[model samples]
Target: MEGFLYQASIYLAAAVIAVPIAARLGLGSVLGYLMAGILIGPAFGLVGQETADLQHFAEFGVVMMLFLIGLELEPRALWDMRHRLLGLGGMQVALTTLVIMGGVMAMGHQWSVGLAIGLIFALSSTAIVLQTLSEKGLMQTKGGRSAFSVLLTQDIAVIPMLALLPLLAMPGGLSSRVNEATDHSDPGLINTAAAHGDTGMSLVDGLPGWGVTLVTLAAVGAIILTGIYLTRPVFRYIHVARLREMYTALALLIVCGISFVMYLVGLSPALGAFLAGVVLANSEFRHELESDIEPFKGLLLGLFFITVGAGINFGLLFGQPFLILGLALAVIVMKGAVLYVLGLVFQLRGRNLWLFTLSLAQAGEFGFVLISFSRQQNVVPGDMTEILLLIVAMSMMITPLLFILYDFLSRRIKDADEALEPDDVDEQARIIIVGIGRFGQIINRFVRSSGYETVVLDHNLAAIQRMRQFGVKGFFGDPTRPEMLHAAGLKDARVLVAALDDPDAAVRLVTFARRERPDLHIIARARDRTQVFRLYQAGANDIVREMFDSSLRAGRYVVENMGLTEFEASELQRTFYQHDRHSVRELAALWDPDMPTVENQEYIARARELEAELETMLLSQLEDSSDSDSDRKSA
Candidate 1:
């Protein structure tokens, strides 16, 4: 127990210290975990051999992650990706394998050895790629969706890969000897069906090939049936317990139970979890399942990456640094070439092309599993197993850097290859709306309904084009650009409305417009109080907080439900609004852009005083209303 506590503390401490710093530097959490592992394992030796065992346990995170992903996708959506799944995904694995196999054969390796190596390197890191894409908010993009389809296809392909490996086994039958010499616990750190060992339990034990197949099919069928027919009642029963923790426990139980079933049947637990998730996608309790499983998924995935980093054999890596590094690079380049061609063939251009290419160029966590399995099957030589392990780890470690490169390229490209040319400004009006998003659309509709002519401009060409389809004329151009503003009649416009979603862009437009047209009245949208102050400083005549009016209405409803009459609620709400506006104007003068709001003493004191004043005023109004009601009853 003491040892477990110490190990937990060390792992937790390393994560805490390293992850935030990495995030601050924009290196991402995966890289941070890897760095933390390297520090604790190789550099400091604070953690030792147990990292291998912990790796197997930590791999459960991948299962949970797939479950969560499945929850988000309905069967229909999965079907829609069938083309990419079969075409792009199939070609990637096949071409990458053939290419690598040829490379290995050229190096004088046996055909069996080359084929084994090829299969190992064909797959890419799913956990890292998905996590990174999510973090960067690129998951909804064309490239991201394409990558996901390929990943899903690859995951499904793992079953056949597992079946094929044992067939390629050498005559030596070195399974036991290799298991002893190599760390089956580590296996170069990947989530694969190969990791589902025959220990602790087995439903398919000693079964014939046909029996195993039937049991696997039955297990999957049970999962689908359970998700459709059993989950609702099970959740309702758990709901009767009324404890929040019960819901969480049930969620964990569903995941763990499914995983155990998959393991017993000699199938991938992650695949089973994903299947269960998809089955429950339309369930009423879907969100609850996601909320309960998300944190565990993140933590476990982090632990898995840390294990990957810790399991690196630095001794061997340093011994053949050039050869190992060269092999890793070769795998990346070869995979990239295949992806690039596939991307082009599939009509993926510019950012989407690069994103698909660079993101999946690294060898996946499953490479570790395949290599270890190959060693056990005597397909790969013992001396080469260490090299393969190092190669897989190195490639996974470098995956994040590839994503960083994608991000850099994305920034430099900025959709120039695909962006339509800015629409010509052919007309000018007295009033101009700088953005035509949700906030500006309402204003445009109102003004047009009132028979006032106004020019609309926006940076998003798609949005502008969409508006045109609805008979709302809008020009596609950056609102902050001086030429776009002038073309929109900023000089002659009486009122300029800045409703851009980007706060910085709105500020820039307001500042430039105020300078160009001193007499113009500018109304700018502010995301929050800080943005309100920013817009005020930029010389916007009126700054409207985006949610301020809606929030006031919601508060009024709350007070009305709290025993106050409708009239009384209205009076209180009006008083609050007036007081809030006055307080904001006063506070705006004290707000220093250079200092943190919490650290500004004068601002803090004034804010407290304003809060007290508002409370006292509200109480006085309530008392007056009560007295008036009493007098009316007496009369």
Candidate 2:
């Protein structure tokens, strides 16, 4: 017990200390985890019991991570992204695999060995791409979304690639004597879940394949049904229990339990868990669950990556220097070539094409599992497999630096152009949005789509840099300054919205905007009651709250009327500008943070009913008035 406690403590401490320091150095968490893994596993020999055992456990983390990602994507969102995934991602994987396979085969390795290596080399790190994009504040930009679509497809493709390993094995039985190989696991949930495969239909060691498959299918079917039928009630029960700690614990339990159950069925736990997460995203408890699980997820995932690093064999790498280097080079070059062409076909021009290509040209974490499985199945030679694993580790280590290089180059060009594009002294845009957050993003879309030119002003250097990638014209300076506003075309803009997320920033910008363009309609953001009144005092013509009213006014109508869903209704209302100035005046004046959600729900329902009733009543009065006038005229 004491030894178990000690080992667990060491793992936790290593992750806690190493990840932050690595991030601070701009090397990213992938490197941080690698450092942690090395410290815990081989480098320091802290938990140096055995390398392979530790890896088997760490591999679970990857599975869990994938399941979680799957949960985030709904069917519709998945459909929307199918093009990029099937086209861009498939092309990237297929072409890269073929190219690398040819290269490896050309070097006199057997075709099977070459095929195993090529598939391993085809994948790029989704974790690295998403993390870099988010860290750089490109999470919502067009380029970011495009990258995300491709990454999503690649992640989904991991399952099929894993299934393909057995087919690539040679006729000869496993030749090399196993170096203390761990006995095969009892056909647990994973194998059962994958029972659709050829081997999945047969007995491997002892477990009944048919029974396992049936049970696994039943488990998945039950979970899906339960999620659809019982989530709201379960959440209500947790909320009523009212212990914040318990509620948070329950959320974690739900995620972890579903994930574990999925693994037992041979499905990816991360994908299963991620599906649960998205279903509950709209719940009131979402923020709480996110806050609780996010910290643990990060640390565990870091441990997973670190384990990947520790698995790298420096001895093997040194022994076959040319092979390892040649493999790594071929993998990167092939991926880059495939990505560059796909980007061009997808109409990703100028900077985004390079950003997409350069950022994703590496062997992915998934490659480790693929190569290892292939070797176990007698598909790849032991030495060849070891070399591929080393290459993956090195490629992952270099990915962050590659991304940073891209950012550095992108900014240099943007800075040069912005400096050179002199302001039109006499002509300025008729609309301006400050901050460019979600709220500001909406206003910018609305104003620009309505035929009014809009210029965005923001203080965040990262946000400004990201927006430039999407071709958003903006002044990357504080809107609180008179000179900055003038430079941003604010003085000439007929409408200025201080839609910053920060209340103080919004107020400061509001005051500056009012002073500079007194006649302009200055819409400002408010966090609460006090902030709205504060904005009103500061001469804001319109003050929108940061909560639901500000975000949802345009969305509710399409839900009551059409075949539209929440997202579609929201988008349509936004596009049509149906919620006019008068409707906002009626709603915004009375909003308070302390107001209960039930009351708001009742009010919206009542308002819709009242609107119909009043319209009918007005029609009746008009008819009577018209008859009286006609009677008087006849007399």
Candidate 3:
């Protein structure tokens, strides 16, 4: 127990120390976790030996992460992405698998071994790519969405891979040796069945292959049904108890139960969790479940990456440095080449195509699972397993560096493009709107209704067409392009309103407009506090958060519902809005995207203190008004 505690302390300390430093360096938290694992495990020899044990425990994080991802994806959204999922995602996997299989076979491996290895290597890390894209605010970009679609397909593809792996086991191969290699006392249901024989302890046990398949399908169907029918009632009962802890526990219980059922039927537990999440996607409890599980998922995923870093066999790497490094590089180059071609074929160009290529050029976390499972089935040699694991780890480690390179290259390209001549300003308008989406449309309506000459520009052809049908003239072009901004009459426009959906693009436009036309007043729409800070840095004259006004109105309604007069609620809301706007500017000045986590936390604490001070001042003013009212009544 003492040793266990000591190990825990070391792992915790490594994460606590490394993650913040990584974030501060702008390399991101995933890299920090990997670095932490490397530093503690390989470099200092502090936690290297314990990595194997920790790996199994950390894999649950992957399972939980899948569940949260599922919660975010509704069935309708999945349907909408079917083309990209099948075309971009499916083709990438099939092509990559065949190419990798041929390569492995060229090295004198058997067909089965080649196929298994190829399939495993085809997958890219969902955790790393998604987290990186989201953190850098690229998720909404064309490349980011394409990457997401492909990753989702890969996740679903894991189901068949799990089933296919067992069949790929070589006849008369080292099955016994493989079992011995993977032997663990608590190896879970599937491993237990494989080792000790099917005991028929569960209903599906002792079933024929076809029977087991049917049972597996039935189990998945049952999960979907339960999610659709039973979850809401169960959650309602839990919510009635009003115990947040209980709600969290129940959320975990549901995920665990679904995962266990899938495991018993010899399926991917992550797939089962994902299916359950999709079923509950539209449920009111979806957000609640996500909130409850996110922290656990994040911590476990961090541990998982750390273990991946720690588990790297440096001795093997040093012994065959060229072979291992060559293999990893080969895999990345091949996958990246395939993704880039696919991106071009799909009409992606410039920054988007590069992002798609670089984002998914590495072996994913699932590669570890497949390699381990293949070794257990004697499909791959034990020595090969270690080599493959190292390769996967090395590939994952380089993913962040690829993204950093992409950023650097993209900025240089952007800088070069800045010299391009602006488009001819044919029709000068007093007001210019960058985005004619929902927010910009409303603003355009009000501005034009008041008799102002407004020129609107939008990149979305469909949006432009729709606006034209409604008698709104919106030019179709990229608002971030200097030429497009000039064509939209930025020079002559007194006020420029940027209401673009892409926060990064909005920031870029703001920065460019500020630099080019400093006299023009820029009103930018921010999605949240982070965007607010970014836009302020970009020199927006006024930043209006997308939901701030609606939220204030909601607060006023709440105050009125609590028996306050409508006028009083309105006045209170006005005061709060004014104070909040002031606070936003003051607080934004302290916010730095590249700041260390510790400093960011300290800033948050200080902001909370300021909020308390504001509340106290407001209360004192209310008390003084009450006292004055009472004295006037007595007089």
Best by TM-score: 1
Q: What would the per-residue lDDT of candidate 1 be over residues 274-389, giving only the tens digit for each residue?
A: 88999999999999999999999999999989988888889888988999999999999999999999999999988999999999999887777787677767778877888998
> lDDT-based ranking, best first?
1, 3, 2
Report, for every candidate in turn, its global Cα lDDT versus the true structure.
Answer: 0.88, 0.67, 0.84
Q: What is the C-alpha RMSD of each candidate to the true structure, in Å?
A: 2.9, 12.7, 6.6
The residue-by-residue lDDT of candidate 2 on 1-635, one tens digit each, is 99778877887788789989988988777777778877776567676444445555555555444445445556577678778878887877788788888888898988877777878787777666765676677756656767777776666666667668778878765544122122323111111122222333332325486876687678767677666667768878777877878766876677767866665565555556655655654555556666666655665566667666655665666778887777676667777888888889899865687788877898876676576567667787654555666788778777877777777878886775445433333336777778887778877877788887877777666677787788877666656767767776774678888888778888888887787778889888878756775687678997766774735564466453655455545544453343333444444455444776357775566557646755565456556655876899999
Candidate that scores best on lDDT: 1
Q: Please provide TM-scores, in order, for all candidate models, with all chains considered together.
A: 0.92, 0.63, 0.77
Q: Which residue runs does candidate 1 get wrong by more than 4 Å?
A: 174-194, 205-210, 242-244, 415-421
By TM-score, how accurate is candidate 2? 0.63
Output the better candidate (1/3) by TM-score: 1
* lDDT score for residue 28 of model 2: 74
For model 1, the local distance difference test gives: 0.88
